[model samples]
Target: MSNRAAYETVLPYVREWVSYKVWQLRVPGVQVAVGYEGEVLFDEAWGYADVEAGRRLTTTDLFRIASHSKTFTATALLQLAERGALRLDDTVGTYVPALVDGGSPIADATLRELMEMGAGVLRDGHDGDHWSLLRPFPDEQELLALVLDRGQKVPAGSAFNYSNLGYALLGLVIAAVSGKPYNEYVRESITEPLGLRNTGPDWEPARADEFVVGYTGFHAARHRRRIDHVDTRAMAAATGFHGTASDLVRYFSQHVIGQGTLLTDHSKRLAQRKAWSATDDPAGRGYGAGFIVDRIGDREVRGHSGGFPGHITQSVFDPESGLVVSVLTSAASGPASLIATAIVRLLDAAADADAPGTPIPDGVDPATFTGRFANPWGVTDVARIGARLVEVDPSAPDPLDTPTRLEVVDADTLRMTAGNRFGSIDEDVTYDRAADGTVRSIRGGGGMTSEPWSVPEEAPETAAGLR
Candidate 1:
């Protein structure tokens, strides 16, 4: 709308921005897509696909979508519901008897409930080592075993804890009800029909050139550990699929324009409804089937966020203005919710032909701000990391900070990366200057902001305290 450049320009910095975010947060890579009215407005690929190889991400980069995969699974289920084959309220036990055997039938779980993440469940195990009986790398049946054996972590219809195992079972229920494998259903119904190329449920390392190689986040795990070696087979419907942002724009476009030929109007609206509400922060909002529905400032957003070992994917399309945005990172960046919040703010202004003003990067001279400023949210240890460049602590031990590279996100505020889901540093490192043009203090990352410390003349110089 009004030359894509007006909107697209803000997105490409993804490479540079994510690079800083990765350095600030110690993440690996990021891929992002921003759009409106079902059309891609902007898309960016930043950081590395394989950091060791020094590979950079492209709009075509691919990474594990993780729980974002729930959107597809829930969509398929809702499609069936729209067809009168299933009901969001139908109990899982009614269809898949084995789901309830001795304990309770995971099948008895309502499709709506599963989509809303209402199923009380425990994590499969955070260590990422336990394999559910549900399925294995090549075999898919182990998924079912996982639900049956593990049962629900909590009573169904309880709190908002997330369960990857829950969506997996929903996939099986789709099979039992539709009589088709989950992959076949997604491809034939979702991908093929949507014409989303370069998108699928797994990876082919040998076919590396076709898609982006996933990046890892374990600082110590590197060299001896592999984070991208995720179990694509067992992670179906939760964190198994991989695709490009360009394709995702097309996919999200369906929800905006009603994909009149594919997804029905009712189904699209159904997908946008709220199901679960996060209680982590008091400001948390509610969840829909697969999407987390909420408001930012005042704008309402419909979408979901995902995080696996090494990838983060966030996608959302506004229902009214047809605005949409999707960011796929190759590292564990921050919560996608924050991004949705950012988009809502930007788009609200964009819809009115306005743009947020750019903030100045830390403008204070290094000398006025160079000191061992102590803070927990972030520590400011100003040290010269390179000639002619004074590196600030936790902000520049980075493999990515450039001289003018700082991101002045707001008029007077500076931010490095986002929170660490995409491996971004979630800090508020803004600066304050004194009337004398000297720096005052710095704030953010959950601590106070300040200028460089001034030593008293009465104090002994150099290691005086130590002596």
Candidate 2:
């Protein structure tokens, strides 16, 4: 099937998994949106925007999409380049001479170096406690001071050095070249033109009520505390965009190759091309001008992730398929990438189910066999993806990892068609139902029994008994 078809087929499972994960991880709040063929197919949110006040998160609530601001900054720079305002290869000192006159080596770095994260600058400056809200984010003067004092980590273009400090400098370059403040230039040039009403470069006091209250990650010793929204000031270009997952996915959809009004197709190509290998990533991901270029399954994707003091967010799009996924969370330790990747993987698996000869039998309803089940061992979720029913381990890091394909036999019986040797391959799986036809229990896989999940799971009893 086409990706659009596959996404439609598996959307229910994706939604189920997303909701389950939020409950399992105890995330304070989450907003997830998926864009397919330039339209948002799924948009939902879970948990409380303000847990203390009992305010639920909505799809419209604004999130501190930190570092995603880089994409906007990079796009702004490319727009200027397209208009002959400035060249990417121009030295930082060419526009903002303060860094050069201040005797900082950072003045010699090119705008391209900064955008590609090859400028070899500090990740954040000394006294980075501002991230924890101990102090304010750097103002222009303070950011310049940080750059002037030993900011260069290595020679420019020698290696991939991820640096918020570099992008902050890019903001200055933008301001000097455009003769407008960084935020104003981006608002008029990018967000406004795109018709994105909810997106902006920094926290706005006027829209404070629309913004969700970010929260600290769960602590074993204490409850999560709320994090106050603060202006990023000079560093806004690097880490201060506020937006919704809906707008985020839509914005990222514009970055997909061949489908954007924000930049020329050529500029989009330049911005999304792999510029540097990310040595810090074990997955061997690469960085583009302002995007993280990585693979999920076999599909290459370009996107950006953001981390504010108490919020973590991820947005990605498959250029070939025009599929986009964005996850926004309100806690420091939220697994935004993990959740986003799972959505992609599930869609991929659904796509594979559309291949020839793997179709479910005639008159069989895969959805009838789908539900969450619990046994003494753990939780198992039987889900319908595309035309296939597969046993999914919801607790697994990748839910589709080592899945057992279930084939329909009769109305209530399914046979395991494929799985590891330890499983009951080719064995009949029967479901027991209540009088009203709701699934009561399932008997399958190594002859183990599981019932529809209910009741809270309790901690295992030790030799000393449950604590």
Assess every candidate by TM-score: 0.67, 0.94
lDDT of 2 by residue, 33-111 (tens): 9998778899998777776666778999999999899999999999999999999999999987998799888889889
Q: Residue-wise lDDT of candidate 1 within 1-467, one digit each (tens)?
A: 45344344333222333334444444445566776766776676655566555556567767667676887888788788878888879887766666666466455667667777787755563323543213344234555565666657777787776777777767767877888877788888888977887677655576566554444444444321224444566567777778877777777777764443567777777777665568766456777777778775566777667776656677776666666777776544433444444545434433333322222235543344334454445444432221112224434433223222234455445555432333235444666767775556666444555445432222111111101
Worst 10 residues of 1 by lDDT: 458-467
User: Model 2: runs farther than 4 Å from truth?
Assistant: 218-222, 280-283, 353-357, 454-467
Question: Where is model 2 poorest over a 10-residue stretch in terms of lDDT?
Answer: 458-467
Q: After superposition, how far is residue 200 of candidate 1 from its true place, in Å?
A: 1.2
Q: Compare the candidates by lDDT and give the number of the best one.
A: 2
CA RMSD per model (angstroms):
11.5, 3.8
Q: lDDT score of model 1? A: 0.58
